[model samples]
Target chain A: MHGDRLLLGPGPSVPYPEALEALTRPVLGHLDPDYLGVISEIGDRLRAVFRTANALTLPVSGTGSAGMEACLVSLLEPGATIIVGVNGYFGERLCEVACRGGAEVVRVEAPWGSPLDPADLLAAQRANPQAALLAVVAAETSTGVRNDVAPLGPELAGTDTLLLVDAVTALGGTPLEVDEWQIDACYSATQKCLGAPPGLAPVTLSPRAVERMRARRTPIQSFYLDLGLLQDYYLASPPTYHHTASSTLAYSLHAGLGRLLAEGLENVWERHARIGAMLQDALPGLGFELIAPERARLPQLTAATLPEGLDEAVLRKRLLTEYGIEVGGGLGAFAGRAWRIGLMGHAATERSVVTLLGAVRQLLG
Target chain B: MHGDRLLLGPGPSVPYPEALEALTRPVLGHLDPDYLGVISEIGDRLRAVFRTANALTLPVSGTGSAGMEACLVSLLEPGATIIVGVNGYFGERLCEVACRGGAEVVRVEAPWGSPLDPADLLAAQRANPQAALLAVVAAETSTGVRNDVAPLGPELAGTDTLLLVDAVTALGGTPLEVDEWQIDACYSATQKCLGAPPGLAPVTLSPRAVERMRARRTPIQSFYLDLGLLQDYYLASPPTYHHTASSTLAYSLHAGLGRLLAEGLENVWERHARIGAMLQDALPGLGFELIAPERARLPQLTAATLPEGLDEAVLRKRLLTEYGIEVGGGLGAFAGRAWRIGLMGHAATERSVVTLLGAVRQLLG
Candidate 1:
């Protein structure tokens, strides 16, 4: 396992030594005064990363998907109208969770490799004026398409409709101005560009979103994800105890975010952008074509449609066995037709890019 | 943060070096052939510890509460009737999750420190044959009551109703005969007897429960927790991908369970029982009163009612601040009236027992 080195998948990229060290640090009670200090720092740090000064910014105990559910379930009560943007697997999942939470869901469809057209969203607003929330993915990991959250948020701003963003693959790798974009509530996963272990989801809730949660006609539909109660515990001045947090994992995530900040968020983003471009440029030499548009592509995740006569899974296996580098195969509809190469967090290193390019090149050759 | 060890109340117990070392092991893709081998081994090991040969068993990538949700949501759909045994916080939580998942929940109530009665459960079943499930906690960590699961499980068996058990604190600390007791489904956390870090819940579904899931009218309430879709990925014969598993944690859990088996399950259970009794016997001299009856006490967790006029929290703080040992303060109505001492999983050592007793005695003096 030693030489296994870093994980270069779209999610749960290899944790740095600091993150791993945090995991090994002595345990702390979730509500201990000393641990509350760490939790307070974490809240401040998440706000900085989330770019939200929203009072309710915090991390949920589950993974990135939990953050998504937290945002959706808390805002949309049973039988509430919500418009969900669907471009890939995760967006489809958002619709499912929203429906399960008892929302009268309406889908605004987009192709996998393309970003959502804002006009379509505006039209949905026109059609469903009673819609209480608009949920969209900022970075669609399944397709490597980064949606333009900046404009969508502002367009939906003046209205009472809250904006929920899934930044699972977008955070740290790119700019997410939660405040500037006017994101009502947005969720991100630690496993992505944070280069930490999975188990925590960083989420931010705007004042408007908080009000909506308070005004819920029915309970959030899931106790594990009820944001009202969770925020009361995570965002209080001294912080209240809600659940026994995975304190060890929380510490590891804090360390990972520390390293992310020390490297400087902008520079980290640039490094991923540069390395992702290198991989993108090199893949064509091996007969692979880009699955997403250049402007819409996420720097941390590059989706490549498999070339004719090549099997996506076999290529992924060959990369792992022959090169000792792990990459992800396509998910959902892209299965066997595409490969997802993640340059996330610590795995965003130039060396990882070179190793992955070498593996794909050799396998195709 | 080196000496930052926490008095983790009841859970997220201080793990051993082996468990921490397992976490730092190299990450593996959840679908990695090597990882699958480890997963299979872990499944078998859990089945052995659970004392059942149930083919469907694996860890869900959430906390103890998620395990509760998985067992309930998978079997009981909206409008279904179920009888829940509530003597503590977690049992009441089960009632809530059941309600959220849309079950018409009825509770068989018991006071804190008192074990749930089998007669009360039998009467509930006779009263409500429409009830599709009976949920109970084998070890109520919140109140320190160990119920008669052996009789309660059989009392609900053979009918259209299923038996669901929550064994988060009981798994490694006591003997659980799933087949012998006819438990339709059971879920437990890793931080307990398995000695793994917090995160990931091991759960098993009996053949009867699986049939119930298969017969569900609507998809299980939550997509992330839909065991039907997840079992495909976990089962070896027809392999599939469910979710991005926490590879590092899985490795850690596998390593921990391996060690648990090597120690021999029965011996481990007996060791905890012996230590618990020894510690309980020493408490009367310290002005602490036994809250749980001797016949129905939990070996892994002991609740001691604080002496009148003695502050339970201050004494707990004294143990942690002065001696660097953590004991749990009371929860719910028991707050300020009791302290919980846990001898569980890897922490069930004679050294832990001796250290805890000594610390308590010193605090009392």
Candidate 2:
């Protein structure tokens, strides 16, 4: 039996009670009318949570990484040119996925724990004029830096280049306007801020992105992740079978998304901001330091500098073992130096912050 | 609110109670040690269930289709040749996935509700001498035909061509000896015979398949479905994160597989055989005809020819809405003429067959 720990880590955060309840409901056949009804409601609620009117909004059958792969592979053909911003681990991951999708990748770099500059993307666009897609991570979970995406739309406005965003950690917790931001494609996970488990990735594509998919010279390398087929399967009336979807996971997402919309997206974002502020303010007094600059700090995921001489792994283990509180160790450049504490969705609460702070104060003093 | 309907579909049959309870457990962090231990134990149990000592045995994070994608994309490179046996929908799906994975497909045909002859595969091999993989569906869920895989091994004994089996509807339902049958790669879904919710796809690869993956000329096109990385992530002691594995789904599978092992594999298979036999013996007396030949018929999935003048869709809807029972409409060539009734895992009980048969009798009379 796994012990119940307070999940403050990067993801798989404490799921909503409704979501958990939904998961235990009886399994439904993939194409069952009742299951399809629940899934359709999920799409509607997901659109409200995403703040987008995009028709292709539906959860991919895999995790967030699968969503990322779907966006890249569907929009890009082999030998297509894609420019990706590499500010943190997820951005670098975008570059890697673009390469794996058989795209010629041009990377524009920013230091870890910092946001990607839209100006640099503009310059990169000038260099790679034939770029088919430009991608970035809106919330870099590894570094807790949130890139400003508003300026990116104007930079690639006239071109046929489609803008893709990884909103895996940003969607429900942060302020994201997919349509207003001119994001051609965006993908996110159910776990991070959706207050659900980590099995489904909700993705939406703009009409422009769908057009690019339609004109692609080659078939999407993955039949499973093909958006055209998925669009037809999810959005089409009397949906045809593409693959067997987990009705259990879909119901969980439905409940989770319902909770998010019920709380109101703005209120959810504000809760994250308040909880994030509590962590940043109080944890520092307990001998921690904020890692990312305030200008680009992510409200949902906070990367904090560990006090000097503290072993990140040992402290995290102690937190888990002693207090039943879980936090994340750093990755890549921040390894051994930082910890990622997520106050995402249901995990973002005043009581949770107080409990965490009290535990931290006790441990430190 | 979804109604609880009896799922007698070809797949996504009734899930086990323990599996449902396991899914409702508190969500664990993706990399939590306790969760990792659960996953490790799941691997051992999956190995035992698959009856293979293959080192690279783990569940793909998506449904069965994702497992098929992972196998084809990881083993075959662009322009490689693959021969697929097309006896049903899934076999045609195998060809589609292979083609999407950039393999040139040579399709060997058999009519619907019929088994593929090994001689056809031999002739296709002679024609496409450069074929890297021979793919086939072990249990044709659409037609309720179970192919004998024992003959395919000898046909490819000395050749470099690897045999891939889609055991989606076969595993845990029938007697499948992976190593003895010389299956180089096999993938199955949790929802079918595994008695778990449909979220994960359990897959195993032979040493030869692993070697082929290692020697791949191009990178796996989709990073999310890359099995080489998943192998390390699942089997390695200090597993690194490839993608966030859903502890909820993993625990559900662990619980489901444990239930299977606890019941004993032989007893489980026998139970299915017994239940399937019961359905086969009684359904015909209610004016239903078995579509597949008795010799090649699948025990778990029974494709029955609908009586003349009985509407397939109307009867299925009545079965669902009126009697709270569900059965599948036929696919491909069998559509409108057949109904596929599945007796799988938890749904393969004597009580289920009795209820279904009684319902059919009442409706037909």
Candidate 3:
């Protein structure tokens, strides 16, 4: 086993103690009655966390990117038009996956470190009034920006367009209401703020999104990600065989969600908000400049430029080797010039912040 | 955590103790240098287990089915012809997924509980000589039959068609030589004979299969399963980030493989064969009829028809509730009639066979 290191990277934040304990439980068959009960409980927990009444809510059997692929492939068919807000790495990825599935993409642009304007996204949807979906990242992990997802949802109400949100880094750490925000679909990763290992992608789809999926003239491009088939296995009586799901991962996620809900969603959000503020508040004093604008920043993840005249890779390597703290390197425009520090889930604590800051101060000196 | 129950199903038999312990180890960043070392070790061990020196061997992030999708979408372009041997549920699934990717499938058929005749597969391939791929299941988990995958590979050696094998139930539990058998692309699940949880699909592709993937005319249909991009992430220096892999699962699989290699592959295979024989030999005495013919039966999975007038579901449930043993129900032709009992990986032991038989005998009385 590798030595324990503080994970302050973009994601895969430190796992909860309960989750780690759950992983050691004896293996259960996917269709076992008791195991199915665990799955049902997980679904219920996901619903409460997503703040949605969608009956189709469940964890997809892959990571966050698989969740993204599932949503795109399930809803978008050939020749369909989608309006995607592109401000960071994930948004660009949305366009790439949509295009591969034969959808025509209309991009709404914003600077890398700035949130996409809700007005611009709605305008794009209006121009392509027949667009099937409008997708935005609720929290952009790449740039630490929180797009204005709430505004776009209300505007798309009763329109042909469905609002799809990427909540990979935003889910349990920030304020997100799938039902209240009128999000047709949302996908999140367990490793982020969910305090579990990175294997499952919890996704919720509204009635309208399911309707669009059923109404598709062409077959879904991916049989594995096809929500229709997955629903048969997850929700059907005497569930049919879909695939051999990882019951071990499900058990771990169940424990993690149980811990989160016990702490209360509002309380969990508050803790993250406070912890994120502490780190963000201290970075500037240490010569690190925050990437996201003040109004658009995400609390769970912070992207900051390193102090001038220090090699980013060299310093990050020292932080890892000497201090055993892992921070993320910048992507796209910030490559080699910035660090992405994540204070999420179990790692979102005052102690972690103090330790990381002290380590950075020592390295910089 | 759920109570411990013996998993005697098609796949996900039971996890090794070492695997369970490994899962409890600290979670690592997906790209951590030490975690990367774990990945590299896994690749080396997988190469040893797969019995091939294929450079593209790596685990896909989803279950065994995702591995199937990866091989199909990676190599077969739209409108490509694929000759698939359809003798069980997974074979039918192969045709379904291939068709979803826009490939025209020509099926070579056999009875549900019977193995596909290698001569018939050869005949189909010869008739459709321009076929891009010829696919078959090395072990048909749905019916407990081991199809002849070795003959087809040598026949297609000089042809343009690639030989794809589904070793989901065959790998590690039985003799499989990818290099000696000339199999081009093969995929298996960690949950089956690999003694790990059902979250990863270990796949190996020969150089010729890689050549066909590179020569694809159109973009691969699924971006998540695109082997070229996955290869870049798994093999490239300064690896590009494709998705957040579960290091926890990798550690579990690594430990499982290590245990298997330490036991020696031939010894592991012999244990499974002996245990399977003990179970099969006792079934007939218990008024059960074996499904697969003697020559085609798989040592890892045994399909048998229960005594007349006994409800299959009730008996299985009794075994679960009264004895805490989980066995599989039949699919396709044997639905509600046959049981698929698997003794795979760590579950393949003389004690397991004796316990299962004792429970069956008691329930029958």
Best by DockQ: 3
The number of clashing residue pairs in model 2 is 0
Model 1, position A96, has a per-residue lDDT of 88
Candidate 3, residue A198: Cα displacement in angstroms equals: 0.5
The local distance difference test score of each candidate is: 0.82, 0.90, 0.93
Predicted chain B of candidate 2, TM-score versus the true chain B: 0.98
Q: Which stretches of candidate 2 lie over 4 Å from their true place?
A: B126-129
Rank all candidate structures by their TM-score, best first, as comma-separated numbers.
3, 2, 1
Q: What is candidate 2's lDDT per residue for B314-337, written digit by digit as tens?
A: 898989888989899999888897
Error of 1 at A14 (Å): 1.5
Give per-model TM-scores. 0.97, 0.98, 0.99
The DockQ figures for the candidates are: 0.54, 0.85, 0.87
Query: How do the residues A109-188 of candidate 3 rate in per-residue lDDT, one tens digit apiece?
Result: 99999989899998898899999999999999999999989877788997999999999999999999999999999999
Clashes of each: 0, 0, 0
| Model 3 interface RMSD, one decimal | 0.8
Residue-wise C-alpha lDDT for candidate 3, range B1-365, written one tens digit per residue: 36798989897888989988899888889888999999999999999999999999999999999999999999899999999999999999999999999999999999899999999999999899999999999999999999989888889999989999999999999999999999999999999999998899999999999988988779998988999998988888889899999999999999999999999999999999999999999899999999999999898999999999999999999999999999999999899999999999999998899999999999999
Better structure of 1 and 2 per lDDT: 2
Off by over 4 Å in 1: A1-6, A237-241, B4-8, B236-240
- For candidate 1, the iRMS in Å is 2.0
Better of 2 and 3 by lDDT: 3
lDDT of 1 at A346: 88
Cα displacement (Å) at residue A69, model 1: 1.8
| Residues B161-270 of candidate 1: C-alpha lDDT, one tens digit per residue | 78899999899888889999999899998887677888788999999999999998877767667777668878856476556677777888888888888889998899
